[model samples]
Target: MGVRIQMLVALTSLLALFPSLTVTVAVMSVDLGSEWMKMAIVKPGVPMEIVLNRESRRKTPTVVCLKENERLFGDSALGVSVKNPKTVYRHLQSLLGKKHDNLQVKVYQRCFPEHQLQGHPVRGTVYFNSSLETHYSPEELLGMMLNYSRGLAQDFAEQPIKDTVITVPAFLTRQSEGQSCMLHRWQV
Candidate 1:
């Protein structure tokens, strides 16, 4: 009984001294890739842990499906790609900030016929066309994937997540780098 009372008093004193102290349980690191994306979380005094999506996979397909009023991502989006090709956007990272006539964009279009790409007024911006006649900007499409990744990290950590470090290729061009920064800013 005496020990318990002493511990309680000590905790109370600490709380009083640092009433606004907030403990962060985890930090997330995301590898955003054209073909796949992966997330890992690190907590103080613990080894880094990979966070899996609903499909129980460490890496998720970088795909998004736009419906009339909602969006689906990862495996769910890939599953609907065949039936709803026009509405499913994939290879977001590769297409981001690339002009519609870019060689890489042309290659992607040839490789993935299910989706259509269009040019935006911005020099390196591209848009995806959906069945609803809605055009999704590269940033918006990548944002959806990032948001979904954040959700996975939150779910795995069992806590609210607010920050992440995304990994991009070092060989990206200036335009690509700018677009990547724009995406990061949107997450913030």
Candidate 2:
């Protein structure tokens, strides 16, 4: 009878020691490449390290497609490019800097700025809109990619995020590159 009572007490104590674990869902975004973005939700109440990636219905691509028919496609454009390499564009981060007027940007050709301000050269391609009236700037283009990723996070959680963190490389600096921006404006 004593042993039975001790076993019951031990089981009750064990149950009290460790309660059931509940995890919350939080959206997390990661820059897979400079151009591509990935987003997933992390379990809440746990450190940011515990988040697992939820497979997306579509893997977003940075590339955008313009057709003579005035039809446009972004991520889906990649699949159609193998047959016609001339219509595909990739790795536009290299063309973000100033370029010489004589520079000719061709379809499927990587665009690069003629001048290299810092150690990192600015490179990106300019894409044409359906209206053919406006040209997209490299900075603006890249910003759209970033915003898209943020949207993914917001959409998954169905809530706005107050606490956010962005990861940048050690060498990415506007000061070293002689570019004037928020990073350069602040004298760190």
Per lDDT, the best of the predicted structures is 1
Model 2 CA deviation exceeding 4 Å by range: 1-28, 40-60, 66-74, 80-89, 101-132, 168-188
* CA deviation > 4 Å runs, candidate 1: 1-20, 122-124, 131-133, 171-188
Query: Best candidate per TM-score, number?
Result: 1
- Give the whole-model CA lDDT for all candidates, comma-separated: 0.77, 0.44
In candidate 2 the C-alpha lDDT for residue 25 amounts to 40
lDDT of 2 by residue, 22-141 (tens): 544454544434455444545465444322223344445665443444422345656656565444444544444534321443322334232122211344324433233544444444
Clash pairs (backbone) in predicted model 2? 24-44, 94-123, 94-124, 95-123, 95-124, 96-122, 96-123, 96-124
TM values, all candidates: 0.77, 0.46
Of candidate 2, the 10-residue stretch with the lowest lDDT total is: 179-188
> What's the C-alpha lDDT at position 152 in model 1?
91
Q: How high is the lDDT of residue 88 in model 1?
A: 79
